[model samples]
Target: MGRMIVSVQKSILVGEVSAPASKSYTHRAVFAAALGDGKCCLSNCLISEDTRSTMKACRLFGGSFEEISDKIYVSGFGKRLKVPDEIVDVGNSGTTLRFMTALSALCGSEITLLGDASLQKRPNTPLLETLQKMGARAYSKNNNGCAPLVVEGKIKPGIYSIDGSVSSQFISALLLVCPLLDGPTELSIHGELKSKPYVDITMDVAKAAGIEILEQIEQTDPTDPTDPTDQNKNSVSAKTGGKISYKIKGNQAYHLENYTVPGDFSSVSYVLAAAAMISGSDVDVKNLFPSAQGDLAIIHILKEMGADISWDKKEGTVHVSNSGKTLTGICVDAGEIPDLVPTLAVLGTFSEGRMEIKNAGHVRFKETDRLHAMATELSKMGAEIIETADGLIISGKGGAGLFGANLCGWDDHRIVMALFVAGLMTGGTTIDTAESVRISYPRFFEDMKKIGANAIEK
Candidate 1:
């Protein structure tokens, strides 16, 4: 595919647009539906490359999917999965690779999971160790922590403890498979859990599928400072001092039901940031559920940065407009909001002071190292940004003074979309690997055009 070159002449975005459905929720919902005892319908599902990978894995496990209009009707596997005739490839989706790994362990046959180049680089050792501790044989082909995992099926569920700081997907993977196990399962997280909201999404999806999960958060007494685990826990400083435990009752069955996915706050952040940066711009994003998504913290972050942004929780909408006003920078703790960092970094270029993004070290494990990508790419456009071990510190001077340049998307969907927003502020920006946006938001450029952004794909 050829590179997409985005050029913009002016900055005046105005209109109402509906946000796409949540990709995170869609992955969990599809997996849940596939494990259900009967047919289930998923409404407002995201038909993207990443979600398609998860659907493909479901089909390999004996689940069938039929698309009727915008909803997907799923005929479940009923917790009895079949060994795939070939290796299951998850493409670039980390969720698919991780969730399918645990699911494969429940079968009595061997299964191998593979992924694209980016996904292959992602660490899976923590999950493999957890599975091994639960009486399943799982190991990487290269003997490394990364992908190309082989699982000799037959899992015995019991107590399993894992480190939480690496990625919450490990815990969610275990949770997704525990309910289908032959025995009860207890998961104890030994360190600070980053992206805790994604785990909440997993629990919420499990509950919707008729599985009950009990969770407990216990903090350590600060006076007893003798534990080495407590010192390591400080890496995720945003979380409390103690481990969080999740208990799942096994031999449980999933019940099929009609499910509706909420609008994605992560995808909507780009549009909201575009409207906030431009002068005399007003954009309303519809179908957002603030309480359900952790990325809704973007609204609060924008408000703190002096952007004119407001949300009507009852109406399920957010209205953003700057009316020719400039934005100011503010410090943001991004522990639970890693997905918002890229868009926020773009918006920070248009603010008046330094913008600090902290406690988001986990972003490095995404499809690409977002902190390094944003810091390097944005700097090429004349914005001063510092990359720290945990986050970024950007010196904001507003978009009017910023200049555009040729950039690379690092083959990351969020990076491509965030750079497109930057293009609107300053024209003549060309982004290679721009098609990566299809992974999550296939209609991203179209949606931006609806709001009067001068964005063109060439």
Candidate 2:
């Protein structure tokens, strides 16, 4: 049976909390280590369910690891990429599937990849098109472009262009496999790339791996958008579209013997948001990686909504102090920064004015239909929420007390966690699904308890 739980009524107390490991970094490290020639140490890795899924994929790709305490020592066959005897499972990890697909393409091996039920239902048509176009033999046995992908490796690559608007995971997939391209690989992207910070993180990791790319852009104005996929050879000409090209040469190597994963800003957001909403206390979270993660911008969103927040870069901590004053809702665009949408929406319900979040249609295709789920769940807690194609519009009663509600988690980690935050401010009993949160932050309830939220684990 699916599990559901409750949050005890109480305001969260403010205090200093250490940041969690970066899931983004942990995913990157897994891919990077799989390509490395020898043993390397991975420290500070977030030992979450998502990270475990990534590690499982790495194990199938000729990578071996030994975990001593909280650290991992990974040894990859490097050039000798292993072919699994059977299907390689990615679980619910999208990053694992995308990156592993591209890597398998380079190895010239026959690899069958599958994922969890939710992942199998995801629309990966764009990514499949790119991989197949780049000369990787890709076909689905079941739903096309979904999961259960079959790749005949040793791709004959030329110039490949991918749309940045689709999950940036596809872009990172190509970039990670660029080193194994047949020749100088050129990639062009068109349109306004959602989650530019994720691209930055990819490039950052690539640069550290001693791989350099020459970026070419058709023009700088993304508002005058162009689909990057329109530029590929045999690419469907979209009548009118421009492309930004990037080229990476072969025979490249990124040999890092040691890498430390930073604390996750996405996970840390919960504790910080709890501090402001429940206790109205000022707190600092330490060990966050400012250089990576697109979701770290939540601090700015919270600060704009009148939360007292600051960054201590030198000390590696984020100081968040509530004004002990009223919070007013503000209109914002959350498309590029979708993960932070839940936190902002939760905060919006406690504000004086209404909050409008536009340009986040992609939220519908996440682990669950987040926009509808969030609107429905928040409404159960007495929030006036409007569901739109683009995003959610929340009108708050300015931190007024809320009554109880039975909330659906929608099997989305962010959705469940956000409802938990909503419970803190509502001063009411909230029953939420627990299975959804296990998809990402598995220890969410324990983490919340450490910070003094009144929670009952079932």
State which candidate has the highest TM-score: 1
Quote model 2's TM-score.
Answer: 0.91
lDDT of 2 at 331: 75
Model 2 clash pairs are: 20-263, 20-264, 108-153, 108-154, 190-228
lDDT of 1 by residue, 27-131 (tens): 999999999869999999888999999999989989999876658889998867777899999999999999999998888678999999999889988899988
Give the per-residue lDDT of model 2 (tens digit) for 1-458: 46777655666566667876777877887677768787788888777677777778878777887776557788866777777777889888878888888887876778898988878877677677788888878777785678899889566557877876657788888887787665778877755456656666777777765677765656423243222111121111122134556788876765757888777777777777767655466677889756767677677767777777788877888887764676668776664567777887888887878888876776676677778888887887788889997788888888665566767776678887888887777656666567666656666777677666777867
Provide the overall lDDT of each model, using Cα atoms, as 2-decimal numbers.
0.85, 0.73
Steric collisions counted per model: 2, 5
RMSD of 2: 5.0
- Runs of candidate 2 with Cα error greater than 4 angstroms are 1-4, 222-243
TM-score per model over all chains: 0.95, 0.91
